[model samples]
Target: MDLQISVFLLFILFTAGHSFRCYDCLGLTGSCANQTVQTCPSGFSQCQSLTVVIQVGSITYKTKAKDCAPFCQSGSINFGFMKVSYSCCNTDQCNAQDAPDPSNVPNGKTCYSCDDWSCSNTVSCSGTEDRCIKATWIAGGKSVKGCASKSICDVTAFSNFKGISCCEGNLCNCEGNLCNGAQSITQSFLFLCCSLLSYFLLH
Candidate 1:
């Protein structure tokens, strides 16, 4: 009887310690107004909030998402085309607030960037974009190059881009100026938050 009682107490303690909850919602604008509380899965111990802003020519788009996450790191990333910011917390409903926008001020870093199918254009990096990124299609050989925030250079983040690679140093996307042509020896990760922006914009 004592063993049975101990087992019951242990289960109650474990269950109480593992439980977590967060707000879950996604919106096209800077914030989500209609969020619902959701119990997180066993391994999900953090509440996450993400904000993405993208610019194309004269227009700009913003997206926000909040949910329970297994793990999260608060940070921001800036690519020439888009900027993303994320915040995480361990308490219930802690992600109710929106993540802040990434800084727009130029950071004085530069890299080769693609413009209208041309990879020779120079682009000034801004905010947290301290690394250079190069992504090439395996079959087509077509490539895109630009500056990226270090947080977005995670391997798991660039998995969708396949041949995507990142490197450090100014104008280091390739060995020569305007030569975003060959793959460099160093490679790193990419954040898929950019893809999230694309998905939200498309659907």
Candidate 2:
């Protein structure tokens, strides 16, 4: 009886430690795949990201929406299952959803562009996270937020470091209004955060 009880306790502990929901809810880009759409714009809906990538030959333009669901919550409707209507933003990829009007598309652009591929909804504890940006500011073009997730809007971080901009965690980093322009801030913050590590280890 004692051995059986111990085994059961161990299983419970393991299970509790392993259960978690990722930062991303769903969709290849963590762009609010579980949200529904609206038509009349009565109130607000679940917040979701919008991204578009346009590729013509070699050059590509990208656009990302910080949020979209709230803009179309009035006309939201249930399809059949829990698939939910993503019609808020018009795109070939979004069938049941109210996609943004393609006519609104700017010159030199496509209507469906998203780049959050390897991004896992896998929840993570306090630590460095990926920071990616779309290629262009246009509607769903081509972008590289350079993070596990594409848009900077859907970023999730602990309160300890949430003060930093989502663009702060970028890798391969390039020149831009994000991190590249704030080199001094990055270095200063790093030094402050690691001062203890440097002192303790060196000592």
Model 1, runs deviating above 4 Å: 1-18, 41-45, 135-144, 154-165, 175-203
Q: Please, what are the lDDT tens digits per residue for candidate 1 over residues 1-203?
A: 99999999999999778668898888876668888998888788888887778777678888888888776667655545666677879997898887777777888988876543345667787777788888753323445577766665765334224466788888788646447434332221122334446543332
The C-alpha lDDT values of all candidates are 0.68, 0.28
The superposed Cα distance between candidate 1 and the true structure at residue 22, in angstroms, equals 2.3
Ten contiguous residues minimizing lDDT sum, candidate 1: 184-193
Evaluated with lDDT, which candidate comes out highest?
Answer: 1
Candidate 1: give the clashing pairs: 152-191, 153-189, 153-190, 154-189, 154-190, 155-189, 157-190, 158-190
Estimated TM-score for each candidate: 0.66, 0.18
Give the clash count for each candidate. Answer: 8, 40
